[model samples]
Target: MTSSTPLPPEGHGLPQEIIDTIIDTVSDSTTLKACTLVRHDWLPRARQNLFCELSFPPATLRGEERWRSDYEEVLRSVVMDVAHSNIKPPLSAAVRRLKLHFTDTSSELGFLEITSQLPFKNLHAIELLDSDLYRFEDHDQDALFLFLRENPSLKELRLDGVNSEPKKFLHFFSRLAGLQLQLRSLYLNDFFGYHDDYHEPESTFLHSLPLLSNPPALQTLALHDVSRTEADIFVIPLLTTPSRFFDLSCLQSLEFKFPFIESDEAILKMCGATVMRFTIKGIAHRIHDGVILEKCFHHLSNLVRLELHSVHPDRHGIVLLLLEHVPILRRLGQLSMQFVKAPSRVRDSSPPYTSAEWALFGEGVDSKVDQLMQTSNPSLKHITLDIPCSWKNVTEERIREYFPKTNSKAVLEVFRIQDS
Candidate 1:
């Protein structure tokens, strides 16, 4: 019998770069853990990939309370390991993003406090989902403020389904000012801050912030499903007037959802001159007749890219109206339109379009495409249509048949999206 071939030296087989690329593409946690045992040089990259994003209760749990306790225990164990282990280039330094959930439970609040004490040196992004900021005690608030103050590298913050009183909200922003943290992007969705009747005091306090005189520059902002009253009291002043919270002149991208209101028009006018990309969502069929819609597009003079999402049935006229306003956008280059199915509750209320309606809609869009191409100094280049998978066949066939000129130019693209 022959002797077994001797093993190659550690880290001697694959080049380091190639091994790093392979580890980067491994999405399964089990496989990534196995990679850590391969060799010493491979440990750093594998650990970085494994800890880059830490989600409490893991997003996969998705509010299943039964699995939450077990998941939390696992998270605590991992954090303890990182804190006590002697691994080189400690796991704490690899964490770049954190997704945390805040609830009313005492145990959950304690978890948040524990998370704030961790040493995350390179963290840059934080997302808080379904948070109840009003319920936070003084200690809880201090923990969050301390966390933000410690992470100077943080640049993005997102709050979804967050509920707070106007005073508490202002205090949150005030704390951010005290830290002098410069954020690049901010997103607020379904954020509730009481009713419109309280606008006076809220507005007064918001304008009185000392930092309002020298607000930091922000690059991107998004507001979705926020009530008009909340916008008037909280958001409009931050964008329309000079505030130490955000400098609208420096904003480059904006995403706004519909039911166009007066406050939104004011924001567009202030930020439109510099905004290069804009996205409008929740467009209903009834909004095509709104005068506010016409005025809003007029201010986007410098817009280069536009996206229209969740367009309702028989609302094709809105697309035509939008393009008419685009002649002013000499820099316009790309346009994307997304069509989605109505929600289950409203599906019965809004029926799907028949073949006749689709034919008429296609013809109207085809004509608009031709008109846009004929404009002088036409910068238009690409157009994308995203249709739900259920309507993929019918919508794609009709679009191809009617958009002959667009097809000939080879600038049109179609994609199928999941129904949900």
Candidate 2:
């Protein structure tokens, strides 16, 4: 009688799941290949786990053939290997997230084509980072658009460190809207690198986007280093009202970085929104004085949270703005500040105690926080100040001298009520 012998477990008698897990986290390709050879049963699992996110090393293909043949072969192999695998579905279907990370080397069209083949219908999120695809022709941009359009499950899209023409940027927005898909979050940072042809202002682009009949279901929008030099004045009025386009509603959260917030006019226009959360970043140099801030924040009566980022001590104007405008400050739930460098030579400046500068710049940073409580921000519970400072910087020490250790009786009472 021939007895049936059971096959031994794969990978040192461990099960496939454990082997898969190990393969999933392994970063070294040589080590992974060695592990795969441990058994035939382990091969499929190991390959799936390992090559699901394949990154080509330029060192593997060097010389004249690098351009004409090797790049294409490597890319085509990676895509076909992942897409045609019988062990599972397309890599995109299984991939919840994908990141196209490029090191300090030039990548060819082969890489772009591989990305284009990636099944986008199942990708929940994707980030395109630090790529040197400088000045792709319209055809390349259209291919990317085709991918985005087909990505029904994609909810978040982030494009960072991409250098392209302004027309390409506009094309991206147009394609996204044309697809009429649902995307909850979108972040574009340095999408258009310093293009000299962008001689106009930032507002110009802002005003035009909303007019699109089919904007995505964008709940959160963030733009950084997007020069507002051309931001049209009409955009201010356009964003002030709540509007809906396709799946995208009025933005629930908005963040503006750098030069966009440099003008109180822009700030005032944005404050008109009934948005639940608002984050502003800029220098205190342009907020003018307390009076202007008051006017600017007047429309933010419904603001549930306010985050401020400024670099100057003159932000005492900001304190007054908060105190006067956020009277329902008790209703405010969150406050944050991203502070820049502190001023030098305390003694060389105004009286630390009497100055509004002290309130904004000096010791009792906490007590000044108390004044914000007079408003209805009763729900206020979280406060965060991401203060990046140097250890040897005396400015931090000088500024800490006035931080109020205690809140006002009214604020304490509100805390009590909320806690109860």
Highest lDDT among the candidates is held by which one? Answer: 1
Residue-wise C-alpha lDDT for candidate 2, range 1-420, written one tens digit per residue? 432443354324655455567777873378888866865665655655554443343334434455344545565676677667665445555555666654443354545655687654666677777654455555665676667667777778777776654544554555565564577787666644435676555546544555545456567766665545323322222233223222323557766653334343454455435557767666454433555555545645556777776645555554444545555443567777655554453223355443433434454344566555444456776555544442123344443444433132322211101100
Positional deviation of 138 in candidate 1, in angstroms? 4.0
Cα lDDT of candidate 1 equals 0.71
Each candidate: RMSD to true structure? Answer: 6.1, 10.1
Give per-model TM-scores.
Answer: 0.80, 0.58
User: Ten residues in a row with the worst lDDT in model 2?
Assistant: 411-420
Q: What is the C-alpha local distance difference test score of each model?
A: 0.71, 0.53
Worst 10 residues of 1 by lDDT: 342-351
- Candidate 1 residue spans exceeding 4 A from truth: 1-43, 66-82, 85-89, 106-112, 195-204, 212-214, 341-363, 395-398
Candidate 2 is scored at a TM of: 0.58
Instruction: Please report the candidate that would top TM-score against the real structure.
Output: 1
